[model samples]
Target: MVKKIASIFGTNMAEPKGETAADRAYRILRSAILSGRLPTDRKVTEAGLAEMLDLSRTPVRNAVGRLLIEGLLQRRKGSGLWCILPTRDEIRTIFDIRARLESYAAARAAEFATPLQRAELVASAARMALLVDEMLSDPHADVVPRIDAENALFHCKIVEAAHARRLELLLQSTIDVNLVTLTLQAYGTEQRMRSASHHHEIAVAIAGGMVELAGKAMEVHILSAASFVLTDPQADHPAPRQGKMPVRPG
Candidate 1:
């Protein structure tokens, strides 16, 4: 039996720009994975992807390699490449790392961030707030993805302002993992929007030169979000016991 293949583009195709084939392939595949088009736990083959993108095997292989290193894709011992799906324990560990790193970054950003950096952070936060408002007004809006993207940008800017490349890269990796979990757990909810607003508060505190306040706010924000995702109604629950087991008498 033949598997159904999705069309590369249902619309007109513009002329290709001067970008490298590998770069194009990377962007296309990354976009698909991030946007949920190539969903979690889905198997991806080099030949299938090459056919879909109208490219040869080499570029697709390079793109897949980069994605695998970025933790967006994984290769099994006997199976092919599959989209990375973090276990519950992995999710908890990533969130714990993010909470510590982001809080420290927020504090350092408050202390050493330049005026221009502060202004940019403030502007990003304001833009994020407006996006949140838009999402709240129309739950079915197409801006949901954009909102998530911009929210990520806002946090990224804060981390960059801290001027810690090591921390930034670590946070970025963990964030990519967290985003998959967030997308799975947080589809549409007013509470999620409110949680985003709290992120804005962290930005405001940092911009105001309140280092301790910024750190505390960021810590609370990350922990709360992690907890929400872990315990949300849509999240996986424990399975029921199969049979009665012998119990020791007290």
Candidate 2:
């Protein structure tokens, strides 16, 4: 069972300390789905999932229920559970909402971000730029995962800086995790650098308390990403998960 999930996710499963069995199951399955390891057409069963996770059906069942509630999984009348596959229009609509919501967040962040929060946002952008350079320099470097993580961090910092609980919740529900991974995977070298530059500009605007500029930068960043994904056929297909970037030996 462990071997099966490892093969599917391309990494060994780790049970974190103090995590309940159900939480562990949920985290693993959620990662699998959001990381594009589980395709929409893949057949999934409670029994199969339980076997793969090396857990009893109870925890896996509980996890499945949660995923369904979160709209990560949908139950069919007779077809069983399937990963949610948003249509092109659905994705476009999602991005539309994301642009507005995140723009407001960035604007508010410009007005209210603490010194530390601003610093963190700028630092995150710098890190993403470094990651982009590494990927460009090394043809074999697996930098997608790192870039994705850094990108999420940069956005999250902006949200945190905004300090509006309700807005944060709205953004959380609006952003599709699965779509994020696919978009990053589809990005070419040019697009990746463009994205990194946008991040830097947004961060600088927020840090300098340029509220309107921050908002505009965020909106343009999001709309450009949408344009890239909408025009690229590759964005519609989920690629195999990339491993974490390997650390260079000193």
Which window of 10 residues has the lowest lDDT sum in candidate 1? 1-10
TM-score of each: 0.74, 0.82
What tens-digit string does per-residue lDDT give for candidate 1 at 76-113?
A: 87677876645567667767877898899999999888
* Collision pairs in model 1: none
Q: Model 1: number of clashes?
A: 0
CA lDDT scores, all candidates in order: 0.66, 0.78
Taking every candidate in turn, the Cα RMSD to the unseen true structure, in Å, is: 11.7, 8.1
Residue runs of model 2 more than 4 Å from their true location after superposition: 1-17, 34-36, 234-250
